[model samples]
Target chain A: MSDIVQSLEGLLERLHIDVGLRPILSLVILLAAVFAVICAALWGAVRARWISRNTAAFWIFVSPWIVGFLLFTGGPMVYSLVLSFTNWNLIDPAKFIGIANYKEALSDPDLGQAIKVTLTYAVVSVPLQTVLSLAVALLMNVKVRGIHVFRTIWYLPSLVTGVAQAVLFIWVFNPSYGLANGLLRLFGIEGPKWLFDAHWALATVVIMSLWTVGGNMIIYLAGLQDISKDLYEAAELDGANRWRLLWNITIPQVSPVIFFNVVTGLIYAMQTFTQGYVVTHNGGGPADSLLFYVLYLYQNAFSFFRMGYASALAWIFFVMIMVLTALVFRGSAFWVYYESQRPRERRRRVHVG
Target chain B: MSASAKAPTVKAPTVKAPTAKGAGGPRREPLGGRILAVTLLVVGSIGFVYPFLWMIATALRTPEGVSHGGVSLWPIQWRWSNFTDGLGSFPFWAYLRNSLLSTIVPVVAVVFSSSLVGFAFARIRARGSGVLFAIVLSTLLLPQEVTIVPQFILFKNLDMIDTLWPIIVPTFFGSAFFIFLYRQFYLRLPEAMTDAALIDGAGWFRIWFSIYLPLSRPIIIATAVLQFMSYWNNFFQAAIYLTTDRWKTLPLALAGFQSVNGTNTPLLMATALVVTFPCVLLFFIAQRHIIGGISFTGSK
Candidate 1:
């Protein structure tokens, strides 16, 4: 029996394949061992003697997030970072490629175009959406009869998913069989083939996108609500017209919300994927007019199987957003208003104190 | 253009407004102003609602009735068969069942998991919690495409490809963005209720369930509704992971119908409508939840 056991061990070692139950068990044990180490570290910082009282509560709260971070963020993030240094397809062993992928991505014309289009989309859409949302919110704030119903109706489009909403727009923008054309025909003017015409496609998409301004509108409404009614009443008594009131009281009060929406909206618009994808058959539509930054990254990563290059593109985008956000933050001091901010002369005394 | 710089000028006008209203007892007509306001609202509402109405109209049209020009308020012929034909065209029922499974399970998982994580960040000041939160938030910036390859590789290795596991599993971990939203909401809640629960010998789980869950209904409903729609509208993940026709969700099914066959316009429109119908129905049903959801995250 001893001889047989020795021979079996030798055979398994020679084959390099773990045929015995012990090897498999050991592998499982190794995995558990790693898990235990992580759990122990977390507990030590979270609930152990050295930790603070809220450790367990914090750990317990974060427990659900751990799995997501590990799987979605930690694992994939590290994997992709490593991947950005390699040449790997879906199945192939990743070949070590120095900075070739990074170089290629920088030089890619499609990527350049994508960046331009994405910036244009973000630049145009974010401001437009913000203005429209504020305008609509202002309109809804009035004491019109059945205004609540109108508010609900206006907000309807924003609640619908991007896929459905874009599909609805696509139908309306369909060159041959769309309502847009029909409406144009009513005026004896031919509608430009909106989707298929490269010149008009991106613009049309931007216009279609503006229809769902309701999401930001609701936030503006909340901000509007927070503004004291006394101010508006005061404005009315001072003979301030509607535009003057909107320009003065409303805009200043809601400027912070507008700033928030602008940053978020720009990020969202830059990464506009679903509309570009679904409308253009999983690619940017109509001669790449809708070739959004994230869409291009997606195409490179999944469609073209250029994982490393796509990673580079993603990092570039991340850098761009960071810079843009920082710029916005810096610039915000010039535009955004806080109700707590007193007059400029008063602000000096408060700051000094 | 510091907001404060512009404040004083507007402030003066508003202060004068009430006195003016008293002095001028309903002056002669500002008829032009009222007409302009009415016209703007009417035009805006029409623009907002028209596409949705057109979607309905197109879905109602027969093959012969599908004309680009001459779209009217009413369809020339109401082809109700389009709905029936759409339902009959493919495995529509199966798609719905699959969508329910895909959307509901993941939504429940995301809400439960993200909320739990959110509560930790909001309530507990554990070591590394801030760092961990920052790391998680960073993931929000890494567009989903960046990680799709590795995840696909991981799923392939796990033999979970072609299954709903890909869509369902990640959601169980909790989304960083949603968790952030929930955390902000949780932070704003009064601390007294939590302390009372602790005094009553309620365990963490018990407090979270019995007190926090009930109190956070608005955010919970909003998150759930949003997550439900997220799963429902998910395209690339479904498109990549689900190969078999039986496994297709509504978006994938609808996309397939558009691309695979030639110009069968009526059938295509019908299929698209069916795919979109649930979301629209959901929007109407949960309209109140929508506003609440936006408020929690939109301003922040």
Candidate 2:
């Protein structure tokens, strides 16, 4: 067995696979071993009539994902956590440093600025987008002629995002000649340098983010259509005005949709990268004001070769998402009204394809 | 959507004809409110439409026309040469072929793998499938930032960097979000359909291949189109993985074009338009399927 193992290792080395890859390759081997064990156990169980045929089928069907989860997602997460504590440049053998990366991250001024910028972005974009999307949805739900045409046109901005969005907006946000400033000139208000101005760079990026709110608007339309029409009538009979009905009925009816948008918006805002990276030409922004947390993390990992430090930043981001998501979920009880769960909700939940 | 739209009106008998101005059953918006709403919608639509118009205009304009950017909606001179010269700058055909290979292979894999995993969770019975499904959903919250570095390291070690393998390989593994999407559709399918297949001495694969797939036309198209858009527009993965100019994707290729041809705004827009127009055209053609899939996954 030792001789066979030695020969196999020699064969692999001759194949030009790197030493750094040996760990992941071993992880893959371990995964296959575990899969083999599970298969043997399943076979034994089936022969002994310990588990049902249906249960076996489920496992067989689910096998690919289980293997994938372990090999790709769960394994990488665990590996990165380990990487966070070690000084590993991609080229070198990693040194085991003890919490040095995390300690340095706490004092890193760039990380501080990145965090501040990220939070400002999340705070500004989330609520505004949620409201804007909801308002648009409300209007969309109006039973007017040619509404779907308007809907299609509104959703156009959402079609192209990421790098293309940033590229198009480059001309749009140009100081002397771009459309944004030119439009502002129509009102005789001088526009800032927009993408070039440090004071305005973050705001310009925020506006770019909002350009695609029409995507959320589509969801809001669906939610609005889901609202019970009887509630509106009943509210009207009680002499409630349109404003009151909007405040009381329309909102509560679509609170679940609102909840979904807010959560996703928060998450997306926190990870704002492509626009900042593209617009800034991958070098943060004017005075690094547009340096988002993920951009900073990407720079550390790939650009600067500070892999361990980037991993530490990643962990910090993970924790923030966990805490923030949990908070939103916990607070959702007060605001979000799921019609299915409501005691007085009149209709049964029907599954729509 | 059709059911939701029709249901409230038929069931409740409250929503009146929208054209019934100031009707008693449903108070139509007053004249002032209607005008205000219409104005908002029109203004909002312009906000969305103008950028694309500008993009097209910029793409068609001469270099001098672009630099002399006045408030003109029409190009001073329609220069088709912008595209020829701009796309001619790099190995556009090579980059496009690279982009297509990356996109097509991954999209097909994602659809296949995700649907299989989703079917197991939806139709097959197991002891711990629920727990596994919950774990899958929770993992959706796991940021790519956390896994990106280690994944790169793993790929690097395997000598896969600068190749298309890194971008394409992960999609063969199931994406959690797409899994959840397919699972939702499969779960809502009647249990009797699978049971009938079982009674006919058929198996899980047969039922999935025949009944479930045939009935799932909308979702399959939606998933495919969405996946196509994602792969087509993706920049970060290409930036991280593909080092060579020859292997760059459309988005990365456009970025390179922008950097090198920075002075020629029209040429830059032309390249950007070349990258963007196909997707925008796709959105127009498959708007229904795209919206159906997105709004389906987006809400509950």
For candidate 1, the per-residue lDDT at A23 reads 35
Task: DockQ for every model, please.
Answer: 0.26, 0.38
What are the models' TM-scores?
A: 0.85, 0.90
Off by over 4 Å in 1: A1-48, A233-244, A340-347, A350-353, B1-35, B128-142
Alpha-carbon RMSD to native, per candidate: 9.1, 6.2
Per-candidate count of clashing residue pairs (backbone under 3 Å): 9, 0
| Local distance difference test values of all predictions, in order | 0.72, 0.80
Candidate 2 residue lDDT tens string, A30-125: 557777888888878988999987888888777878877876788888888999999988778898898999999889999999999999999998
Clash pairs, model 1 backbone: A235-B14, A236-B17, A237-B16, A237-B17, A237-B18, A238-B16, A238-B17, A238-B18, A239-B17
Backbone clash total for model 2 is 0
Residue A99, model 1, lDDT: 81
Q: Tell me the spans in candidate 2 whose CA falls farther than 4 Å from its real position.
A: A1-38, A344-353, B1-32
Error of 1 at B157 (Å): 2.7
